[model samples]
Target chain A: MNYETPPLLRLCNISYSHPGTSASLLQDINFSINREHVGLIGPNGCGKTTLFQLIMGLLKPDSGTILLEGNAVTKSRDIKKLRRKLGFLFQHSDDQLFSPTVLEDVAFGPLNLGLSPDDARDVSVQTLEQLGLKDFEGRITHNLSGGEKKLVALATILAMKPQLLLLDEPSNNLDPATRERLIEILRGLDLAHIIISHDLDFLAATCTTLYTVQDGSLQRCEQKQVHSHEHIHPYGDYPHQHGT
Target chain B: MISEPFSSGSTLFHCSDARVKVIGGTVLSLVLATTTSFAVAMIGFLFTSLLLLISRPSPGLILKRIATVNIFTLFLLFSLPLTYGGADIVQLQYFQISLDGMRIACLIAIKTNGILFCFLALLATSSTVSLGHALERLRLPRKLVFLLLFSYRQLFVIHQEYLRLHRAAQLRAFTPSNSLHTYRTYSHLFGMTLVKSWNRAERVHQAMILRGFDGRLIPLKQPQLRKSDYLLLASLLLISLILAGFSLNNPV
Candidate 1:
């Protein structure tokens, strides 16, 4: 099968490990993603998170190039510029929701981007409204429900208006209804999104293509098409791409 | 870690801004320094209290918070008269109390009350973020200002963590009741909280770095100084000056 030429994010000969840690977290890894919605499924303790960070420019690969829209992201300055085009949601909602209120928290990224205060507020309001969180503007982020907090965290980055979004466990710990709402929200967002989740059904519904990480390497799975109907959840044994 | 909980957003705290609080408060404090007379400091204390009330802080709540931090001040207050004797104009049933000591105590109270009251008005009314914006407006070192801004950011998180740990400790089935085990548990928690905070700090730092947080506090759209703000600031300075002048000349 012929794949599309040139991806939104292309990782070439990428390898990374924690700077002070004894062992390498990921190495000899790479695959390009042009798919609008992609899934990165893997077991616990794998370098799934590290790889996401690598792509977000949170961590630098020890050796190799991470080219974003054809520009190498090795230097700190370039990484800063590259980051403006990417929105990242960490696994923990508490890590991202630092502002006193939900609206301010969501507006954080937009504010950092130097958007006019009025414009930032509007963007944040619109983003939160999309997540059914318009009523929670004055509410403190810590007071929100687990599911609500996750959505609020996503809104914070969404307000930044990034072209590429990187989400870690977008559906983790959310109730079925909340998770479903997340799926709907994901479906509505028009951008290049890579989600790291253990929820297969959530992934199957929201993503157009899927990739799995095994033993710290990223491979292109043959299954790139969305499941035909929403009647069944994808779990257990299915065709998975072997480690490349 | 950011310095304060909220950066300069449109919270109730930002109305006055930090520079006005810092400079204006400092100028107000000078009048207290010039005079030991009760009336002069008393007037200063009153203005500060009025500012605190206007900030919309519950009087009881603000007092309770102020009291907790005042334990050390209380200690200092009690020991102040020791080894320093003054002329005694009145004698109690058993001991003669020095008039000078009485004067000194009064002075201390006035000075302490004035400073604390002013600071409370500054922080509780003006958001920490506003203070940062105020600092930036004042043309301070940009690097220092940014460091302070980030430090202020961590204040919100640290305040939350302190609340969390206190709750967790309270919820634990057994209270240590001032035993070594209690001390050990508290110490353990302290270490744990530090480690957790450090990890969080690292993650936040990474996030900040990704956003091009060069060591500069970029102006969040230069906070415009409106006419009313200048009016209030000028009036406050005028009040401080008059109070100082009257206090110094009063032959009480």
Candidate 2:
């Protein structure tokens, strides 16, 4: 299938391996994210996160080009400009919330994007309030509950108002209510995002398309296929349909 | 439980601007460090103790902090006197404690306690994040300020990671013993902690870059100093100057 307009994000023949090692972590990865929330499911170390790093221009691929809205991110300046339009939510909320307070953390992205301090702060407050975290502005990040930290981390990304979001395991460690809140937030979002998670129910609820990584290659899974797949949990061996 | 002592108070020192508190605390510590006279150092200790009393941190916490410092101070007090070859203060069968060494040790202990009490009363009275911001506003190197902020946020994460790893080990029925395996297991724990920390740092850096962070972190709004801040700084400075003048004029 072909489209007249360029995709929001396009990856062309991306491959990567750790330096000084020949075994490839990601090989010949190609995907386009446009008008859909893409869910990525895979085992640990299956290069889902590497693909994200490549898209975000954090890791240099051994071969290929990353195009954000059809423009190649070759130069540092180009990456910087492109990065402003893309947001990445790390798997660990600890990595995302590095600022001393929630307000500072949320405002960090806007501040770096050249907003004035007051304007950045206003944006931060609005973003936090939108996420039902208005009171977390002055809260110390570490002192927050696990669920609160996850939302705050998402707020940091949303405050930047990116065109594309790359969320790594956004639903991990979230309670049912918090997870529902997150799904609601993601559903209401107009931007395209590729969310990497093991939570099939979470993905089925919010994502329009799904892909699973296997043997360093990405394969798209239809909604029916995703629901029928066997999922594992630490508590018991059970597989149930998500009914997407 | 994680909250710092005196960090939530609205006392005079706590209400003062962090920039003033940081500079005042540092100056007082420096003055105490440089005072050669035992009497002047004791005066500094007394001054810091008075400040601590006024600030009213938990008495238990203050005692615990001072006791922790005194463990190392006790080592210095006992050992330094035997090393310096000067006038004999105590002649033992195996060791001859020098008068100069004993005096130096006393001065060192006094200075140590003075500085610790000063920090507890002033800098520790406020949140460390504010202290970092104040330092940045005071023209401290941006890298240093970033380090402080990063450490303040990441240290807790690292500690939690460590505890998780330890719990995992315990779940596997691993117990510590004085053996090579125990040593190796501890080494592995530490090595894994470092590896996890490095990976976390890389992810954090990636998240930063994804949010359009260039090399430099943009500064937030500068804190405004209130009249009370100025008063606190001035009074602390005046008291330090008088003590300094007295110590300079009459060197004991």
Candidate 3:
């Protein structure tokens, strides 16, 4: 594909495994992405989420170069700077919304970024409003429903105004309406994003391209191939209603 | 899992500034700790009861908090009298309990329960975010406050994670048994929990770092103390002084 802008994120020769384990979880992962929405689909334990941790510098690849906007992310200091440009949404919203109240949680990033408390709060409020969560400001985070928690978690990241978003299972446990809302929200964002989800229809609605993880390697997936794959849902027949 | 369940109430205690509550509660706990007389402890108990009556917290929540604290307090009942080895206050054919030990134990229990009830009425009545803000306002170390918030958030998450794993095991026909297999299974479960916990912590740290979080956590709001807050603080201090005077005069 031809592009006018340089890739927002670039990974080269990335490989990693848990210490003392011989099997590599991710091997020779070469990838680059820009502002276009991308989807990552893979079976459980196929190193999809591990790739995200690597990009965020939570886990380091044994040998590789990761560049964010052309800056190296090998050192802790460099990772610190690179992270601000990227937002990672964990597979579990419970892991992300650590602050007591939705407003506090959303403001956490801005506060850490050295914005004054008032400014941080303003940004949080705006972000929550953008996500249609204006009434959740004083609500305790844990009291939120699963879908609400997901939106709040995303709001916390969006409050940072990141250049790129790394979303893992963004549609994991949402009701159909919430999933539709999430799809619309994802579609509306102007920033680049790499979303990992098993919900192919949801991904089809929001993502411009798709990649499949197989045996520790990422391969570009054809649109037609994605629809043809036979998969079984453990929770009865897949209930997702796809747009024609 | 302390519930800030009463935070939304329109009660006077709920509306009072968190900083005032924090400072007043600390001072009161200090007084409770220093009281050398049972009379002072009794007054502290009375104060706790009054606070409880006004706050009007769920009786079940209060009982739960007391039950949690009693786990540690119960140890004193067994160890205090035997360890002190003083003059026997209660003599029996098989064993004797020491008077000084008995006195110390009772005093410690009163002090603990008094402080705990005070905490429930003051600190627990406000949201944790407000409590964290109150700590920041009081100029407590920012890193310490950050750690406090981090732990508070993770406590429930870690607990729920463990419960989920336990439930998964139960679904797989696993049952608690006094056997090596059971011990090994539990050990593995604990080890997995620790690994998952550490991984979760690392991810949370990364997420925080992404938002420009340095080592210090900045307070999101700085609520101002109102006139009512000062009034409440003054009343609390005055009562504390009167209680101290009575305890000083009427020694146990």
Candidate 4:
């Protein structure tokens, strides 16, 4: 049987809704991500986070299949293979990191994969070193600065060396210096990525293509074209909800 | 100096066959715990401590873990002698309590500290996940085992929320105070944290169901026991038995 190699991630007519909520929060999320540094932008409650959760396998679609590398991503068995191909940097660093120390936190994913204790430990140290966070190896994670915690979270995923990096709000809670370091780190890593952020400048700087979540659907926008539109203001009315 | 060996270690303990750790460690602890012999407890403590040391966790980590049960010891050390009555050196006037407190306090401290120390030694070398598995192997109910697992997951997530709350408070202008007003604010904060946690838990449960996580968490691979692991278990039981035998006879 000749089977075509699957794309990195594909959502075919995917839709989901909360149990009691009548409205479908996400519908027809039909997009195939292969090699673009895709920036997903939308106002709060516009299904941006929901899309992320679907990709991360934390939430499943109510009506469609989300595939990783051409394989269905529904099974726990598939998640191991899918996770090997995708690294999800959760928006909340605390949720991403549950371990007590820096090294242990970084090692969580690899150890979960059943890598022997010695091998997992080695990979964690190397990942931390590559991120220039060698000094943070033994520090208690709770004492870390906002940016440091984010770096640690990213490192936790980086250790996995996934083909597609799924990041949620990479610049949130970061100082400019740390943000720059993170941006550089992301730029240096050669992998297909889906970065979700509200920061227009960050999207403009790193993304080759921008996809905005609007009206329960994600629409890919034309590159180098800024339409005259009311973008979502952080502290004001959200753009996606305002428009339809 | 901070070696969080427990947190970073494999799903080995988490995914390991339950019988391996629970039946293994508990039987070991039981043989050791009920034995009132000083030699076995001391030898078990030393032997278990050596095993933990070989895990390469830092000295500070070991000490910090051992220190957690000190609260229980504090009560035993202070009140045991007074309540039980120690040597008659000092006596309380109002309630007529005598001061044979020192000797009784020593006995209680040693006894309590010894049991605690033995358990610490076992846990230091083993993971709780392994212990949980051991219980399941010993025919503990599946629902109870899962409840333990779910609560463990909840505890960590709740801890994360607490950190966020504390950080938010620190960022705000409000100074920490012991006044009634501050205490009221603290209660309010605690209440908010609980509400937030419940909402998150609800979301997580839905997510779990969506992902087809019905009651059981059948791991991809099963745990296999090696010859050396049994050797280690055997030596442990032997040492525990000897310690119990000696301690009971001596009662020191």
Collision count for each candidate, in order: 16, 0, 1, 14
The DockQ scores of all candidates, in the order shown, are 0.29, 0.53, 0.55, 0.07
Q: In order of the candidates, what TM-score does chain B achieve? A: 0.73, 0.89, 0.84, 0.71
- Model 2 CA deviation exceeding 4 Å by range: A1-6, A17-30, A41-46, A198-201, A210-244, B1-3, B73-105, B215-221
Task: Give the TM-score ranking, best first.
Answer: 2, 1, 3, 4
Task: Give the chain B TM-score achieved by candidate 3.
Answer: 0.84
Give all candidates' CA lDDT scores.
0.73, 0.85, 0.85, 0.68
Looking at model 2 chain B, which ten-residue stretch has the lowest summed lDDT? B1-10
Indicate the residue-level lDDT of A96 in model 3: 83
Which candidate comes out best when scored by TM-score? Answer: 2
User: What is the Cα root-mean-square deviation between model 1 and the actual structure?
Assistant: 5.8
Under CAPRI classification, how is model 1 graded?
A: acceptable
Candidate 4's docking class is: incorrect
lDDT of 3 by residue, B190-251 (tens): 98888888888877776676667777766776677789999999988887888778777877
Q: Candidate 2 docking category? A: medium
Candidate 4: Cα lDDT at B13: 35
Candidate 3 ranges with C-alpha deviation above 4 Å: A1-6, A12-18, A21-30, A42-46, A74-77, A212-244, B5-8, B38-49, B58-117, B172-192, B238-252
